[model samples]
Target: MKSNFFRGAVALGALALIPATTAALADGEASSYKALDEFMDVFQKVRSDYVEKVDDEKLIKGAIDGMLASLDPHSSFLDARDFQNLRTQTEGSYGGLGLSVTQEDGAVKVIAPTQDTPAWRAGIKAGDYITHLDGQLIYGGTLDEAVDKMRGAPGTQIKLTIVRPGRDKPIDLTLTREIIQLKPVKWEVKNGIGVINIVSFSANTGADVRQAIRSIDKSLGRKPTGYILDLRSNPGGLLDEAVSVSDTFLERGEIVSQRGRNKGDVERYYAKPGDDARGLPVIVLVDAGSASASEIVAGALQDQHRALVMGERSFGKGSVQTMLPLSNTTALKLTTARYYTPSGRSVQEGGIEPDVRVPQLSDPDYKNRPKFRESDLRRHLINEIKTDNAALEEDSKDDPRFAATAEELKKKGIEDFQLDYALKTIARLAAKPGGAVAQAAPVRKPATH
Candidate 1:
């Protein structure tokens, strides 16, 4: 009798929900149709009464772009060329000028040239503003159009007009495009301590890292007592590579977890039972520019008490993006979900805080530089919890800790003070009783192939 009553109750509840659910669906359909009608009305008006004639394809694509741009800074509708470029980014090679840029204040600004590429080899510095490509004025044009102009077939030459800070006149350069191959992992045995610099994450980053560690260990002839991981200014890439790279350091346990809009969209990635370092005291370096995959590695190691995270706070981008292909050789790079550290903390607006806050005194513009964070982006998600961090504009005055300018530092042979300090600290830790890192190995260029 009890079973019958429970079944009857469930049936009645189902019957009661049907009408309300149907009504809600009808309301949703109506609202959607109304929005579609409004869109068409505006589209017709623009087609018939615009100041200048516009192509149908251009208008439609522009509409799609504007719609996606309204969502978030990361979400965008990619054209055919953009799709190809993204594929090149993940595959780790392409025929282009080898540059990374961002649109800021209606201008395309250089983020950083890919390491060891034509741009980097040609001495293209970050923070430079590009004014023209091939003598074409690009300020009023779209950034993608300018980028498309910059990249081309191998051995093809292109000219760039650049406006750099601290320069009196615009600089022009004629560069030949080449096949850019990114070497994601670089290692050095510095002062008896092993140091790894992860420049970017790509398809083969994990395998490369494993090989690098093996090579360093073999050259060391013994396990190093200390290791330093440098990830400063790394813009980040490939989520799978991030997981695999984190796994390279960790023996076991959760590396990262991701959750989408739905409650059932939670997924976790765990590390295997092996670590390349063999339980060495590791220190990770980060700054405000470190983001995405780099942040993942830093946050995971920090939460697991595996490494001491130093330098400034991260760039605070914890969202995952999936490149979904569309018709016409186009794609949609959508922000699919939010990622969390093992400690159940979201790094959306509030990025991973370091175990030790070590400012980059070597960055001469640290004080006056305008730092852009996720919070500054339009339509960025909010953090679920509060965070404590250094002030965005601490002070423009010169820091007493670092009195030397770039030229002065070059004279002193201090190329990177942050790396120098971390290496020394690790050396000190290793020097303690019964502990010392391996002797320094000869610095050699890492092989990308």
Candidate 2:
């Protein structure tokens, strides 16, 4: 009798929920139709009564772009040309100025110029605003249009008017376009230390990094004292490449975990059972330009205790973007998930803080140069939990160790002060009786499975 009563109660409860659920769903559909009607009304009116004859395709594209723009800076609608450009970029070769830029209130802002690119050679620092393109005021244009203007034939030259903070005059620069072939990994042995510079995490970046380690060992005829992973001014790329690179150094344990909207929707990546560097001390160098995948690598190594991160705070872009192909020539890049470091730290607005706060005394404008990060962008996702790193910043200020100026550093034959300091620090660690490897060990043991 009790079982029959329970079944009857469940049937009645389900019946009671059906009407309310149906009503709520019907209301939602009605509201959506109403919004669509309003959109269609505006579209029709604009088509019929606009001052100029605007093509339907242009209007539709603009509407789509505006919708995505309202969502987030990273999310966007890629047209045919834009889609092709993205594919070329991930493949590590493109015909452009090699600049990663974003739009802010209609103004194009430089994120970071790729190393060895025309923009980098021209001294276009991050946080500079691009006001004009080729003598035309492009202040209120779309980012796509500005990028299109900057890219052209290999020999073509374009003029740019930049407005940098802490500067009086608007600087004018003339840059020639070229095929930007990105060398994802470049390695060299400097004073018994292996320095590997990862410019961008493009295609095959992981394999390239592994090969770089082999090449460095081959050149030295033995293992170097330590390794410096230079990721400064690197505006991040493929997520898989970042995971693979982190896995190379980490013998085991969780490298990173990404959580989607649902509570249980989580995916974790782990390292295989192999340490490519053989437990050697590693130092990662990052700056305000290091973002996304760069942050992933830095955060992983730092949390895993596999490397000492030395430099300024990273760009703090921790959200994962998934490319949803809409058609053969276009797609929607949507922000899907927020990634966490092995220690469960979200690097969204608060970037990866270096273990050692080493300033770039080599750059003359290091003191005055403004920093651009993910938080500065409009519509950026907010991190609910704030990272308590204010004390870290306070500690770095007025540090006597980094008081030397650019002129003084040049006199000392140190073009890159941060790198020199890192190299010297590694040397000192190696000079210790037990070596750097003894001091450097993973916080957790290798996972058996």
lDDT of 1 by residue, 341-400 (tens): 877777777777777666655556555455556665677776667665555435456557
**Model 2 Cα shift for residue 109 (angstroms):** 0.8
User: RMSD in angstroms, all models?
Assistant: 6.8, 2.8
Clash pairs, model 2 backbone: none
Clashes of 2: 0
* Model 1 stretches astray by more than 4 angstroms: 1-17, 51-53, 95-97, 117-129, 134-136, 152-179, 388-408, 433-449
Local accuracy of candidate 2 as per-residue lDDT tens digits, 304-326: 87889999999889999999999
Top candidate by TM-score: 2
- Kindly give the number of clashing pairs for every candidate: 1, 0
lDDT of 1: 0.79
Pick the lDDT winner.
2
TM value for model 1: 0.84
